[model samples]
Each structure stands twice: as structure tokens, then as C-alpha cells.
Target: MARLSDQILTAIFSLQRHLLEGINETAATELAIFEQFGETEITIPALEQLQNARQRLTDPCSRL
Candidate 1:
């Protein structure tokens, strides 16, 4: 089995956190835009991914 390098692991974790935070913020912003303009179908289903990313980031060695 191949081992995960520390740099790769750290980069992956960092990306996860960044993506999670970005998605959560994006979702919130999308909702705001929808509400402000009375538009529909702007849901990106990002919140769930965001949560998953967060979980992955918080849980060490769970990538395997």
C-alpha cells in the first residue's frame, strides 16, 4: 500500500477546511441573493459537502 506524504496530507486537510468554509459562506450568500431578488433554484447543495469536509478535517487519519 502506498503511504500518504505529510505534505499531501496537510494540503488535503487544508483544502478541505478551505472548501468547507467557502461553501458554507457561498450557500449563505446564495440564500441571501435568492431572498433579496425573489429568485429560485439557486441551491448548490454545498452545505452538506461543507459539513463532510469539516468532519474530514477534524478527524485525523480518517482519509484512508
Candidate 2:
């Protein structure tokens, strides 16, 4: 099975946490622009969406 490397996942999770901490609209817009081109940019349905999914997903992984 193929999956993202651990380093990649860590970076993604870290980005999620960072984004959730608070981002003004202007910064969010800039991030959205970067995501459009960034190789693993946090593509947003919005950071809240990503954060919700992150909370759900990471919980199970913690048991392993």
C-alpha cells in the first residue's frame, strides 16, 4: 500500500495546527493562493474542515 511518508504527514498535521491557531482573511487568501501551486499545500475547504478531519483521523492512528 502506498501512503505519505511520516515526515510529510507530520508537516501536514503541523500545518493544520498552525492554521487553526488563527489566520486572518488576508493571510488565508494568500495561503489559498500558495496552496494552488504548493506541492503539498493545505488545500482548504478551509482550515476548519481540515482540522475536523485531522482530529478524526489522527485519533485512530494514536492507538497504533
- The prediction achieving the highest lDDT against the true structure is 1
CA error at residue 52 for candidate 1, angstroms: 20
Q: Give the clashing residue pairs of candidate 2, or none.
A: none
Candidate 2's residue-wise lDDT over 4-48, tens digit each? 999998987786665444433435554665567553335444555
15-54 in candidate 1: lDDT tens per residue? Answer: 7777666656655665665567554344334444545655
Highest TM-score against the true fold, candidate: 1
Give all candidate RMSDs, comma-separated.
Answer: 7.0, 13.1
List per-prediction Cα lDDT, in the order shown. Answer: 0.60, 0.56
Query: What's the TM-score of every candidate structure?
Result: 0.50, 0.33
After the best TM-score superposition of candidate 1, give how far the Cα of residue 46 lies from its true spot, in angstroms: 17
Q: Single out the weakest 10-residue window by summed lDDT for candidate 1.
A: 39-48
